[model samples]
Target: MDRIKIKSVTTLAEHWGALRQADVEYRAADGSLHHLKREIYDRGNAAAIALFDPARQTVLLVRQARFPALLNGDPAFMLEVCAGMLDGDDPFTCAHKEALEETGHAPRNVRKICNIYPSPGAVQEKVALFVGEYDAQTRQAQGGGLAHEGEDIELVELPLDEALGMIESGELTDAKTIILLQHLALERGA
Candidate 1:
């Protein structure tokens, strides 16, 4: 096995917003030196949560139009989980808000499951995952998605098994959602 040693990392260009460019030098294990240049898109960070109503035997999800996925021809834009960018706020707070907005369901119980990097190649975004347990009866239909932010989300209620099946069948391609749902399934011994 060969390892690459990072000699140094330098920021080449930076914007006022969340994306930038960088350059780095590394020493190959075989004693060769190399330079790598790439753009760094800093999304600040984000969080996602799986909201489940055990009493109702249902899970909350959202269907939103994803331009990239649409371009890729995935008609099933439906996804499982509540997710959003941190936006300079606490990850837990952001996750809670995203859950309520995306599903119109306020969670009574929430737990942090994991934090992950969905794509480390270009986007410098880290997603913190959560599992929220709530009473479906108390949910409201308040139209919680943010259209100004380019979100036209449709709330969805699905059976646990069906949601899991979607994961297996590749209907759910969001990485953070997958991580949370997989953890939920494992916790329930499903």
Candidate 2:
């Protein structure tokens, strides 16, 4: 607090998410004062889960439309692990709910993997990541995502090795999904 002084925070835009510009002064490493202005997007925190089936050696993921990615000249449809905003729920509960809603499988033995700020430079979103086991017995719904929420999701099941290969082929580009997959591989000593 002594090193950083926040001069003012002005809301630039407010809609589905908030955009604010912060004017601040910072003490540099050499004890020099530096003034800076930064714009931040606040969309709240979220949770994500990777569902792995040991018996089948497979992983469950979802594909959905992402306008931002399309705008960036990437594919509009992105393949990613199950994830959703916390919506005031705890991370663990959000993880489970997102899993069930997006993957059609309620995971068992859910375990926390890590927490990450995917885009800390501009967005104030901390995602809680988890890995959990799933099998035939866990299928509880069709899990196509909520249509009313403008989500049209496609469920995808891939062999672990194939999924890893997709990462190399540029097919799987979502950061959270890649992290969870690599974490699982590390856990398996692969």
Measured by TM-score, the strongest candidate is: 2
Candidate 1's residue-wise lDDT over 1-190, tens digit each? 2344444556655663455556666667777888877777785788888888877667888878766777888774657577888887799999888887887777877888878988898888888888888674657656448768777888778888888888889878887777777787888898
Compared with the true structure, what per-residue lDDT tens digits does model 2 show for residues 1-190? 8999999999999998899999999999899999999999998899999999988989999999999999999999999999999999999999999999887888999999889999999998999999999999999999989888887899999998899999999999999999999988888889
Error of 2 at 190 (Å): 0.6
Which parts of model 1 have CA positions greater than 4 angstroms off?
1-17
Please list the residue runs of candidate 2 whose C-alpha ends up more than 4 Å from where it truly belongs after superposition.
none
**What's the C-alpha lDDT at position 20 in model 2?**
98
Which is the leading candidate under lDDT?
A: 2
Query: If scored against the real structure, what TM-score would every candidate get?
Result: 0.85, 0.97
